[model samples]
Target: MRVLITGGTGFIGAEVVRQLVAEGGHDITVFHVSGSQRRLADVADRVTLIRGDVGNISHVLDAVKTARPQAIFHLGAILSTASDLDPSAAMHANVNGTFNVLEAARILDVPQVLFASSIGTYGLGMTGPHIDDLTVQRPLSFYGTAKLFGEGAGNFYRHRYGLDFRGIRFPGICGPGVRTPGAAQFHSWVVEECAKGRPYTIEVAPHTRVPIVYVRDAAAGVLALARAPRERLVQFNYLINGVPPTPSAEQLADAVRARVPGARIDFRVDPQRQAFIDRLMKPVDDRFAREEWGWNPAYDTDAMLDDFLAELAAHPQRYPD
Candidate 1:
């Protein structure tokens, strides 16, 4: 399979590229903006890398034309914190970038396009303990709004153009070397800091809970969805949960302490950040993803932590202090 991945040098995107290289049949092209390719250095020899921004239609068109990919995994976008900081930049990157990818795929006759959506698509005023695939999406942040728009646009492309457009609404993706600044990022940093024998603080309250997926599971789940039989999919986009039973801040900290003896983990609540989490901490129901496409995560919390630490230890250069 010939595949092109936007944002293929990012955290999850890098993992996807690595996995594809390991799987051994596909020819992969990574489309990314100018920046460090450190995340992909290990697999750099195996895949083709292209420098470009998804927000630019010309760049998108050229990438698709050159790669002639059968599949395009559209993972490029402005994340929450950055989006909130500059809404205009977010609009150009997140919203326009998605449109550019979809249009390019349609024009170039790409058979399948997989989108990366987010839990932020569901916001305050949601009236359920767990938000499912069918829940109304009224995203509070510009980032979430853009993701929701991607879902809608993908559905439109699927129905109107006979494109195999699929998307996954992922929860907080946790793993090693998460440098992105966001309220939920602590889920990753707590473990990473502890693994480095450095003191880490949980900004949110101890009891605050949120769903998270290990980065590897996230990459696998999206790829699995992309490869599933099209007829089996009742919906174009699906919500997916990672791990089981969402963990509180304290529970996660305790888990880390258990693994790394004498790990220093403390909580000093940031009311503003806690409020941000409180509004969007509901568990997600991904039954549709499981039943329709056989989505199953390989790691539980403990296993995820173990592998995360091992990766940081083994590849200390990949994630530097």
Candidate 2:
């Protein structure tokens, strides 16, 4: 199976690439923007690297034509903070970029396109105890708006052109290389910073809880969705809570301290930042994901923390603070 992954060099994308290569037999192509294989250091030699911006239709089309992929994993996007900082750029990258990928798949007769959607799609403000597949998609940010639009567009392309479009609405994906600026940064940063013996502060309150998933689980969810029998996939996109029991900022801090013992962590809740963080961090129900495609996340919050710190510990040089 020849595969092409857009934004394959990103944090989650890198894990996706690693998982794909580990499976073996599939020829992989990474279409990235930075042209830097820094995140893909492990599997760089195994996969073909192609430089392209998703916003550039021509570049995407060329990459698609070359890869002629049986499955296209579209993971490229402008994230939350970046989207707020520059919505025009976000629109170009997120909205227009998705369009380009779908269009390329359609024109090139690519059979399947697995999109990376987000929890941002839900318009439901204030994530409460329960959320299911039927939640309304009224996005508050440009990033969420673009993702929701992409989901609809994928649905359209699926029904209209028979493209095997599948997607998962991800929670805060926590792992190494967590550089995207946002309140959510604390989720990954707290663990990495603690593991590196560096002091870090959270702007949100200690009790602010957000849904999260380990990077590996997130990647696996995508792969599982893609590999599921099409006949079993009555869902266009499903919400995937990668880890159970969304930990609060306080819980996260405690976990790090327990693991590292000498880890430094503090909190200074910022109301402004907390506004959107609250929405994005809201709890998510993934029963649909689990039932529809066996989307079982191996890591719960505690397990996720253990592995996250362990990974950082294994590679101290990679996480120097």
Top candidate by lDDT = 1
Candidate 1: Cα lDDT at 275: 87
- Residue pair clashes in candidate 1: none
Name the lDDT value of residue 295 in candidate 2: 86
Report the C-alpha lDDT of model 2 over 248-275, residue by residue, as the tens digit. 8898889878888888899887889888
How far residue 143's Cα lies from its native spot in candidate 1, in Å, is 0.5
What's the CA error at residue 320 for candidate 1, in Å? Answer: 1.4
The TM-score obtained by model 2 is 0.95
In terms of TM-score, the best-performing candidate is 1
Model 2: lDDT to the true structure: 0.85
